[model samples]
Target: MTLEISRLLELTTWRVFDVADDGRVLAGCDESGSVQLVELAEGGCTELTALAGAVVGRYLPGERAVVVQHDSDGDERGQLSLLRLDDRRSRPAPLSELEPLVRDSEHVHRLLDVLPGRIVYATNRRNGVDFDVVIRSVTTGEEHVVHDGGGMVAEVAISPDSRFAAITVPATKPLSDQVLVADTMPETGADQLRELTDRDLAARHLHPGWQPGGLVVTTDAGRDRTGVARLDPRTGGHHWLVTSDEHDLSGRLSPNGRTLLVLTAVDGAHRAALHEAATGEHVVDIALPSGGWCGYPLPEPVWSPDSRFAALSFSSPSTPGDVLLVDTATGTCTPLTSSAAQLAEETLVEPTVHRVPARDGEQIPCFRYAPAAPDGSAVLLIHGGPESQSVRSFHPLVQAMVSRGHTVLVPNVRGSTGYGKRWYSADDARNRLESVQDLADLHRWLPSVGLDPSRAALWGGSYGGYMVLAGLAFQPELWAAGVDVVGISSLVTFLENTAPYRRAHREREYGSLIADADFLREASPLNRASAIAAPLFVLHGANDPRVPLTEAEQIVEAVRANGVAYEFHVYPDEGHGLAKRANRLDAYPKALAFLSRHLG
Candidate 1:
């Protein structure tokens, strides 16, 4: 059944951000992309605040107050705000007014943990480039820097006893980074920080969280595949807690530090497990609902204070995301919200996973969704983040196109995560265009699945958007139409104009502009705009900071100058992607209409 754009928009999407200590309330964003506090008993949600940008909130331990992270114009220089649930006031006050400890600068601050009378966080406020672990008092509003060093600080985990903070420093090589445990004493300095793991310098060690005896982290340190391990903060010794043949394995310790919730990526799908934290013995293998894998940032299963139930957000090919409460002991799952119940009931296409061979003999993983009725047309939906993978997540655009009888293929091309460190970085720098070649291979492989090559369209956002532009330019005769959503048109321009704090990270992944300028220009779609033979649709947000609006404007100008059939759109309030429901409702239908007009 073809669902209307309005019905797709009406689907209330929810994410389980944080569960209250008593497990009575959950905090997340509602359908409108606004911060909301949800009551577990009544399944009712209260809209807390409506900001112009995206916001992620976490509840302070044992308190009704929440710490929210938001940025201005999607620059990603996030700031933490405090909102009191007990306040009878009309709206929660700003962070600058409520918490004097936080600065209103272009710095990123993330709440780590809330202790008895203190709140621990990590911010780049110290240098505006590298993050430092900071602990601030809840009542006095005084803050202290616990760890400030050279490398970028990723995740910070505070011990239950409030004695030490475990911080993960990501390196170019996923495994070679270091996890340091710093004493949270009043006058702690850089000298007080002790490296918990001997740097492998080649393997990936990430997602550090505190367990009862030591630190639990995801690492591929002596193993071919990434797995969960326990590290001794005192001796710098560690042992693998869970290992699998799968490429990615990550886990989180429950609130009571007794149960460990483990998630592994087998091929591209996720398999969850519950393990005993002390002995690392498997308790029960979780049966995830048939849909997509849990959404990214991979919702760390929020455990009830009693450790009986865990809350997380799950989405699939057919349904939008919703919060689910899983019985940790029984392995039974219950839906906490009915956000996607109706959509799940709809006759949506269930995607079949396929491993298509690339030009270079490498196997490229893809999910293909074919409409029941034949339309002799297809669309290639690429994922962004040369580092991100396209999982079985609920995709409204894909569903809409499929419902209209367009076969959709979502490929996890080279450089996508969840495929091990080596595979994840395969297309870095000069090797990037090989991913586009993979797309070309996808075009050749389409007919094997009963798709028409002549009527094919390419659509993507962010990095995927770059792929669409590249496909149209390089393989000019391959595609009938193309859509770029907030995608980068020029690699050189994107690196030069992206936010200062993000420039270094992007350079590491995409190649240094100073060193690889010529290569970047050659690889950019803007440079090859004259080669584009297909009709193109470009959509972007004016306030985007990552792939700045200029990325879209320059390409649109080039495409129009070339006299190619093209359409352009910009959302004034949106930062990166269309996070707001109203904008999506307007954009998705227009995109589908454009595809229909051209591809059909």
Candidate 2:
């Protein structure tokens, strides 16, 4: 039985964003067309904010209110607000009634942490470029600029005593960052800040969480894989708590300060374990659903007040996004949310992990999902981030295409994470075209996995979208068709037209406009658009802030001038990617139809 594309598109998914002391869960669900805030407490679900795109939130100290971070119709200009628990309605509320704590259509205000009497956040309201960590009083509404980061502050962690603020900022190298510790309330003339990690070394220091004595951090400094370490705020000394020889590890201390949840990245899947924070003793290995991953931004498990139970957002190839409650003592995993929308589990396909050898002898990690019935054609789905990976998680588009009898291949080419720092940085700057070559390598090696190279189509979003256009332009003879969603066509134009604050950050990975303009132009697919003869389908958001709408128009225009077969559409109420289900329903089915005509 074939699952209709509309049915897969309409299926609801939820993630446990936060867990309260009283056992209340704040989750984001797509049950109402778009992702909205909902409260799960005492055996019932309460509707909170029905906002646009996706919303991020955390419960206030007493669990009486929540600090919500939401953006306008995919614009990505996030605003912060405080909504009282008593004020929430059983029905959806209009945007106008949700009064703002800090609202600006131009500047982004991200919610970091909600403490007892204050809220900590990072905002670019001052210069609209550099983000500053701010501590605002919940009762008095007074603001304190704790760290005036000269550059972008990636993460922030307030000390248990509210004395220090640990933040990470982008380092000089690509895919690397440095941690900085600042005094939350400095005295009249004291030195307020110090760099915890060596500024001389280019490494990734992430997920700074405060414990009793110091900050628990995940870093790959002076090492190949990320590992857990404890950073002393006063002396700036790192004590390695746990180091893995094979895989990357990220540790987060529970609220009770007794246990630490450690997630190890084994290939693309996650292996979770709990450890004693004081002695660093291994407690129990959490047995998550086979092939299930605690999905990205790579959130820490939301622990209960007693630190005995943890709520994790788990998903596998067959499962939709859902929450799982784990018992730390016995490692018992229980389902907390039903996000599959009652779809039969057997109807979905699970991908088998593979390592396709590249021309340079490097093995490229990939996931292959074969259809139940043969269609003789294949679709190669590229992940964006160029720095991100296609992990073992529920992917609606992949499932729908597989249901249509198309063999799907998701490759983590060079520059993809979950492998390590070396692999992720393999395609940085001057080596940009090398990662593109990995696509060609995959094309040649497709036959070993029983896929026909000539009948394959390309599909991707963002950087992956760039891969679609690049694959069509550079390796035009290999693909049958292409589907690009908010991808970059020209690297030069992308750097020039992208959001101001994002330009410098992206330049670190894709090469800069000042020094490497010629290379950026050469590496761009739009320059070789004339070589592209394959049928193409393009979709973009009119208000996308990351890649911008111009990137899509440029490729679409170039292909049109060449008289290449193509289809293009823009959703006015989206950004970066399609967040609303209605747009996905309207766009994806057409993309599938286009592939069917060209590849089938």
Candidate 3:
């Protein structure tokens, strides 16, 4: 049953970045890790552009061009390029050529919308610190700032008539707590910036976009669960578009602005539905055949220009990801690409969703993958972004371990999103240690599903990596081995050393180092590394900007001083995660070996 590493690496990974306005052409990353333009009718794929490292942004209005973001060595501070499909013989040009909106040092650039004669975008090029909304003419190359503010412009949307721009200004508070609807007049330079929504220090209002009458956003303003709501920019009136008690709802307006494509996440699973934009009447519920994660870049559901079909990216435990077309009328789905066809003969395990209760009576939703044969050993995989969820995605490492007879349990811990806002922010600041307790509760519940808690390993990246370190430091007896990947070890140092642009945002979630100094030290696993009883493996990218290399080095220093068995690795060319296939191939096997040596 030993599978070749090459076979696993060869699996075609696909990610749908954008569907053309006409929905005839789909743009996405292909097997070679390059963006390709696929024509739906003929099923012909043409290589659009290839770079050392690039992520396809979105297609322009008429599908004549696309925005590609490229970075070197995963630094994240990369340049944006416009890949013109019309110029088939020419290569992508740097976005600066069109207008000097993004400089070499100013790496954050986002395309907001494409108007009649201009393209609207958001960039930190104004001060290289805070984002500013800019409108650049397509023909003249003249640009004007629509909204310049002291805070980071998180989201931006240009109205269809190109008169107003709705921007989410997160500077009002630590988190994005306000929305500014402004008139984009070239003569005034956005002098009239009006507040569209009332500020709530506790609630997060995000994804501001324009509809026919007003602005629409995802907010938990008056409820625990985040839902889609329409806000009147003029009168500050609010109307609920979609609301749910058991699930969180967020969506996007169709190209014609007649329908709303609602994305719902219930217990870590995603479902899509089309609704009447004005009446909130559900039209058709699109069935997702792939039981996996969806909507990575917020509202990824793209409607066709005619609003007859919607295209989206989907991935499951067995499938990597593919662009799917869903008919609005009948809700029939058709796959536009087959990225996981290479694994057709391989046996993949389907994850079963289970709710395990924590000591405090909170239900932790976990995805369990059981092997065909019993090994009496298991691994608990934690997800990053304590705000993110662990959905049923195609995880090669999980499959590899399961293939060798190991059960894998991935939990959507309390702090994870896709749940209500209250549950998502449950682990803020001092309350984060409670999340570690949730991990212990998960270990205690393992035996109920025929798993041996004593023989279990803990594995995670980013925040999950922090959880791995926490599990070893706090609940030492629960895990046999642990793997930490690009995780925060010292909260205080991490807050001080992380990228400046991200400091305030991280402070909003993890608690500020200046204010919560004592709590940060108390929760940091590095300070309590002496309590670790299990063998540890630490993996990180040297270029990581979020957690930084020091986070891993400091913990390795502690483990070495404690005389604990441990392995440490740092990929020189990677950033947050092992994004490059070669790095993954090199790093994952070492992780599998470490788990095997300790847990088996």
Best by lDDT: 2
| TM-score of candidate 1 to 2 decimals | 0.92
Selected candidate, larger lDDT, 2 vs 3: 2
Error of 3 at 114 (Å): 3.5
Report how far residue 44 has shifted in candidate 1, in Å: 3.9
Q: How accurate is candidate 3 locally (lDDT)?
A: 0.76
Model 2 stretches with alpha carbons more than 4 Å out = 297-300, 304-308
Show model 1 residue runs off by greater than 4 Å: 33-35, 73-75, 87-106, 174-177, 186-190, 197-200
Q: What is the TM-score of each candidate against the true structure?
A: 0.92, 0.96, 0.93
The sequence of per-residue lDDT tens digits that candidate 3 reaches over residues 83-183 is: 55653544433333332333465466677666555667777765666767888765586888878866566677777777888877664333337878878
lDDT by residue for model 1 (1-600), tens: 786766776677777777754555465655554444444544355666566666776777767777767777556667777766753555534444344446565667777766666778887766666777888887788888878875576677787777778887766653256787788784644457777766545666776767767788887777667888888877866788887875578787886778888887865567788998888899998777775355464465677656777887877766577777788879887777765567556777778888998887889988889888969899999988877788887777888888898999988888888887777768888988989988889999988888889999999999999999999988898999999999999999999898766777678777888999999999998899999989999999887878899999999999899899999999887778886777888888999999999987
Give the alpha-carbon lDDT of every model. 0.77, 0.84, 0.76
Kindly list the per-residue Cα lDDT of model 2 for residues 477-519, writing each as its tens digit: 8889999999999999999988887888889899889999999
Off by over 4 Å in 3: 2-6, 33-43, 86-103, 171-177, 186-191, 290-293, 297-299, 305-308
Which whole-number lDDT from 0 to 100 does residue 555 have in model 1? 92
Error of 3 at 120 (Å): 3.0
